[model samples]
Structures are given as C-alpha cells and as structure tokens.
Target: MFKSSHLPLEHADKKSWASGGASSSSPMEYPTPLNFYEKPPMFDVKLEQFEQSALDRLRILAEIESCSARGRPWDETKRIVSTLCQKHLRLSSNTAGGDLGIMDTQKEDERRKDHLSHFVLRLAFCRTEDLRQRFITAESTLFRCRFEEATPAERTLLYESRDFKWVKVDDVEKKSLEANLRATLTGFKNIAEQNDAWDRDAFYKVQWSQVPQLVEHRRVFLKKGWAYVPARQQSAIVFREFEVHLRQALNMTNRAMPQMDEDTRLTPIIDHLSQGFLAGVASDWQYEEGDDTTKLRAEQVDEYAKKHWPLCMRSIHDQLKKDHHVKHYGRLYYTLFLKGMKLDINEAIAFWKKSFQGGKVTEDKFNKEYRYNIRHTYGQEGKRANYQAKTCVALLTGDAEYGCPYRFLAPESLQTRLQISYADQGLQSSDIHEILNNKKGSHFNIACTRVFEITHAKYVKKGEGLGQSETVTHPNLYAERSIEFETKKEGPTKVTSKQEDDDLEGIIMQVD
Candidate 1:
C-alpha cells in the first residue's frame, strides 16, 4: 500500500464528530490548529484562500499534464514544474546545490497543500476511467520530478519513512557474479571497467517484476527471479512501484466515488477544476488592449470567417449556414464564439431566430425555448455568468458534435473538409496530407497553425508582423492573428505587447 504522510483519517471517537453527543453543558470545544502542518482542518477554510490555493495548485498540475501529454522530456518537465511551483505555490526547490535541513513550518505547509490539493483532484478525476488515468499519469510524473529534485539526504529520509524493504547484495556475492553483472547491467559496465569501483557502492536486490522498467531498459542484472539494481538507478525502480500503488489506489477511489458526491462544496469545486483542466486554465485568455479582438457585427461574421476564423469555428459556421440550424452542443459552441466576437444579445437573438425560422423551428418556438438561453449566455438572466469562448482542450475532450475538427473528425472526413475549404486558396493535397499527419501524431494545435500558414503563405513569406510563433490553442487567438496578418497589407497593424504575448503563452490559463 502507498501511504501519503499528509492524508487525513477520520476518527469516529473524536469528540467533535458531527453526530457525537455533547458531554458538557457548554458547547464541545474543538481544537483549532494554526495550520494544516499539524493537523487537517476539519472546518471550512476562508473562501479566498481556498480558491487561490486551488488555482495555484491547478496551474502546476495542468502544466505537468500538458507536458506529459506532449511526451516532453522528464528533465524539461522537472525544470518547468519546479519553476512554476516556486512562482505560483511559493514552494522553492529543495535541490539547490546542497542538502538543506528541513524547515518544519514552511516545509509542512507546502506538504499539506500538496497533499490536500492531490486529494481534491482525485475526487474530480475518479469519476471517469479516462480522467483517472490522465490524473494518475500526470501525478506520477510530478512525483518523479519532485523525487529527482529532492536532495539525496531528503530522498533517503523519504524512503526510510515509507518503509520500503529491499535486500542488499553483499560485496562477496557481487564479486562472485562480476561477469554476469558486467554483461547484463549497463550501469555496472562502466564501474566494472574500472577496478575496485564496483565494490565502493551498495547494490539492492529486488524481484524482477518490481522493476519492470529497468528490465525493459536492460539497466539491471537479472539472476534467477531477482534483479540487482544499482543504488544510483534505484529511483527508477521506486517510481515504478509508486505508479503501481497509485493506480490501485485510484481504482479503489473510483469504486467508492459515490461517498465523495455528498460533499456538495467540494463536488462543485472538483467539477470546475476538471472542466478547467480540459478547457485550459481560465486566466490565460483574458483580453488586453493590443491583443484584444474586435467584436464583429452579425453581418460581418461570414467575411471574418473567410479571412480569420480557425478551421473548427469555420466548420461550425458553415454547417450552421447549410442546415439553417445546428445541434444543441454545436449551437452552444457557435453562440459562445459569437459572444466572444462581441455579438450583442439583441443581435444574437435576431441572428439565431432568422436561421432557425427557415428550418423546422418556428419563430414562436424559438422565442419560447432558445431566446432565454441566448440571454443567459449574455449574462442577462439566471446566475448572470459571463460565458467565455471554448478552448481547444475543452472542445477536444467534450463528447459533442462540436469539437476540434482535427481531433474529432475522422481522417477521411477531415481530408474532405480541408480540400473543399482550401480549394480556392491553392493549398496543395500534399500540404493537406502533412497537416493530417501532424494531427495523427498528436500535434493538434500545430496542424491548425499549419492550415493558417498555408493559406497565408504570401504574407508569411513577406514577413508581415505576426506577434509570436506559438501554436494556436484557441479560436480567438487564431482569428486575431489572421486579422493582424490581413490588415498589415493596407497599413501598419497593431501587435500584442511582448509581455501580453508571454502571459498568453505562459501559466495563465483560459477558463471556458
């Protein structure tokens, strides 16, 4: 079993239990700890603190998830995660040149936040198998990064505290098996080549099954049923164990998921976090003056669609035009994009009502069912929440007709659409094939950007100023960049400030 030092256990015997009878006439007093370092706070935290902490942690985890999904090298992921932790969570690196003694107060608080945030995400992710697997993979990578970043002394302490037991290979046995060890163990080969160096270090013997990664990498020497892992490469062995134990724990958590639903406060928070994770962080797409896109008049949408809109949005617009209506998810998606384009509630109603009237939807039926939803989207009704544009991540993960075309569309379907859409623009079939190939290899955003580059090849070759060379992760970003490219032919075009561009590409996330 993998036990986290910071996980909280509920004790029925505690006097402060909600269902327990009071022993004194006065209200039973509960012990209030100064911080989570000493004990888990059973009471509610301040709303601001709760939200800030969750958002900060979410940013870190989201980066880890994105990096893992892209198959980034572990060293790069570790550096990015460590830097983000320092910037957002205020948790500094423990591996700055030398081993430092633990600072109890600071370290404990950091540990508490790490523990609680993980459990919170677990609740969010355990509802679905796909979500659970993603969460586990990202979390395992994060844990490995932290382990690698920790000082050797800190790692030793952590290992000892975890009580993992492995038999050590004796010096005499090591010498007797020198030839086999040299032949089978890659790490040992270097040390074996130098006399007396092999005897200087201790070797741990574990079951061959326990270190499948090393076996797969051919990094350990195997004899009979045991694998002899060098102390230096032991972290790999330990991380595999961590992954296995975590996978089992997550499966168990999923089975007990029903109990988690009772906590209404946390349930909603978890839901939002899951959505944010899928949609990209909410903060990334905040509009600033130079980078902000102009709101298009309803009449101008088709014009803008031709010159600026991304393939996904363009596809949705075309479908709406063809059928004079869209399915529920498609309608919601299209409406939000229009809303981001600054379509007023009145204009939006007129536009939708006109489109639907030509279809099976009567004007009276549209007013009855759809008008209020449009008003709601514009924040004129109900909770008055301002709906933001849908991001590529959210659309890709969503189980809806409206999603990223590069991801959701079948290859044949996508090819057909690309050919039809770009026929007049002179995009070659070879270019289309390359774009689809990139999408197949999981370069989804890159594929979208490639479409833009191909269509705007003249402007690109002429060096018309595009703000930055980033993959288009949002429809709005694509539109804005395309607009800038088109406008530069007539006169000077406004570009996003370096800081704003960096912010968009950095840790600030887009919330849908």
Candidate 2:
C-alpha cells in the first residue's frame, strides 16, 4: 500500500505496515495538508493545454511508428491508424490519409491522410509555417505498413530502417529513468485502484503512451540494429531538443490561440474539460468504495450532501436551485471540485454527463445550452455583478478541482443554504437603503430573489398562476432601518421604544 498524506501516525495503532517517509518541516512540501489556505498561485492553464496538446501529438507519433513509408504494408497500417485516430482524437480515415500525404483532398483512400495530417499539425507546430515544414520533411520510411504481415524480426528491421532512433542508457541515466518509471507505475496503480472513473482499458492506454519516452531515454540509440556512435551524449541532446520544441509550441498556443475574450475562449474549454473529467470520476468513484483508502460508503453520500448542501457546492448549487436550471456552470463547478479533491478527470466528466441521462436533454444540447452560463458564473471576463461567484475552487476545499470559496452558514433560516458573502456588517435597522444605494433600480433585487429560491425550495412563493408576487411580499429588505434613522446608535440612555416609534414620523422616509 502506498503511503497517504491523510493517514494518521501509525504509532497510534500497532498494525502499521506502511513506512512513513521523511517528515518535512515546511507545509507546502507535503502533498495535502489539512488547512491549505494560501493564496492559490495563478492557475496553470498553460500546463493543462500543454498536456492535452501532447496527447494529440502522441496519437500521430504512434501511428507513424506502426506504418512505414517504404510502400509495402500501407493498406493494413492505414486501417489500424484509422481506428486509432478516430477512437482517440475523433479523426476520420480520410483525414488520417491526408495527413500522411498518401492522398490529397480527403478521398476514400485519402481520408486517413487528412486525419493524420491534422493530428501531426496539432502535435509539432503552433503556426502553419512549422506545420508545413514538418509535414514535408518528416521521414516517410517511419510510417507503418502492416503488423501481422511481418514477423517481430522484420518489424524491428523496418523500425531501424526508419530514421527514428532508440539508444541504450548508461548506468546513471538508466537508474534515474527506472526510478521515475517505478514511481509513475505506482502512482498509476494507486489511482486505478481508487478506481474513481478510470476503467482498466483506458488506464492501460494512457500508461502505454508513456512507454516510448521511457524506452528512448533508457536504451542506446539504434542505427542498424547496432548502437549509433555519437561522440559524447547524443541521446540526451535529442531528448532535450524535443522537449524544448514542445514547450515552445505549448507557449505559443497559450499566447496566440486562446486570445479571445476570456468568456469566449478559455471559459468554454475549461468548462468542457472540467465536466468531462468529473463525469469520468463519478462513474468510477464507487469501484473502490470498499477498499482501504476509499471509505466513501454509498449510504453516507446522501446524508453528507444534505448537511453540507449549502456549502458543498455553494456557487453551482445555488445557481441550479434559483434558476431551476443547471447547464454548463453546474457541471463545470461540480467537476472541477471533484478534480480538486483528487478524483480522476475522465471519471468526473463521465459521471456528470451520465447523470443527465434521466432528463430529456442530450449531451450536445446540454453543452450548447449551458456552456456560456458557467463561464459567466466564474467572472472569467472581469465583469463584477452583485451575485457573481469567485473563480477559485480551492477557497472552498483547498483542492483546485473542488474548492468552494463562497459558502456561508444560515442554519437559523429554514432555507439553510450557502451564499457569497455580500455586505453584512453586523449593524441592524433601516440603514439598508443607504447601504444599498449603488444597487438601486438595478438587478441586485432580482439577484436576491434568486438567492432565496436557491436556499429555499422556491425563491419566489408559488401562486395560483404566472405573474410575480407583490413588491411588499418580496423577502429582501434593502435596509433594516429607514435612511432618516441611519445614524441612530443605541446608547445606555436610549429613548423608549414607544417614544422612538412616536418620533419616527418626523424622520426622512424616502421610500423608493
């Protein structure tokens, strides 16, 4: 069993099999400290973009490895690549062919070429110029032809003939690579066993993709089934060069491609990715429920949600309750929260999208309808409204995938619910009108009405038919006191209630 940061010290019990690694003095150095309320460093959106882009690149690279351009086994290789690209990256057979230059303009034979071309472009370049150069110059011999037609020996020969090189590692680099690989394998096992949405097949696929990188880093570079003689350290040189190129490509994507208004670009992608990951996790969360690490009993979920409902998912929950609608915003919020709390991204996404199964809405319809609403809730474009939710997930749970910075307790009210703290200053009375002056003749009142609906089953009281309730019937009082008595402070010698009530007729009663 791999060690967990949350597990209590084993000395408290005698059956301690796990070793506690070196204890650290600093809090940040540890994995998950309980009270991790540091200002979240600016989110690494670039990193996420980089990882996704790399996966796109890998799908094509794998195809190239499988197919050789020597023109022998092209037909069989083409079929394999078609399936792989379509399954993973949604590229069609014609598109894959267009990519490899087997044909042009996406014909029946050319569909594979087109799909492969797009994947390669996404992999190697941030701009069209680099993409053109890479496509034109990439080694044709590296493309795969057929897997079964050739024996392992023949396949190895073909791989060697392609300009693609693999090298044997020296003792030092081999040890380092092996250690890293071990840790990665262990991490994968832990996550898989937690089983929060990671299926065995999908888990294996992701793990397999990392193999080529590991192998290249470890083995000596191959030329003709023999080690290529480079003067000092050519393998390291090649690896470093590849990483540098990839980093630059990723940086360019961040700077140039996602340059639309925060609402238009980053928000939609974030919402989609977040929901995708959450749905994936929720589907798998139950798989490990009885395991040692996961004590998440099914029965406890409903109770936990009830007690924590107000604060559990403050922003999205409130939005859903009031609007009687949950679109993109609700999905993104819940998904991210799950991710922050250590659920796998794929599982989280699958779970959420699946949750909508009982509803009439299809996934596409749901995304189209709700995508923008979520982005708006995050205040992604810097527009500050009275009810706007904060963008930080960690504020709620210190887990980026699941933080909720806007929860508050209102158990005294029947509609006990979470809310973004607005302007409660502990003062009582009619000073509310003056305090809410900026909110006058605006949607702030409407926002308050919405909040009520969210906390209670209905924000507005139900009526016989359509129209809204009377103004006096609305629950939100702009201020507890009138503007005239805004300065009236309670003193030891305060006037009696009867006297104050009698004198109050002379106060300024400017009702809007």
Q: Model 1, 80-103: lDDT tens per residue?
A: 788887887654334432232333
Q: What's each prediction's TM-score?
A: 0.69, 0.22
- Cα RMSD of predicted structure 1: 9.6
Every candidate's lDDT: 0.63, 0.30
Candidate 2 residues lying further than 4 Å off, grouped into runs, are 1-218, 221-245, 258-512
What are the per-model numbers of colliding residue pairs?
7, 69
Model 1's alpha-carbon lDDT is 0.63
Cα lDDT for residue 383, model 2? 50
Best by TM-score, which number?
1
Write out the backbone clash pairs for model 1: 281-509, 281-510, 282-510, 282-511, 283-509, 284-508, 284-509
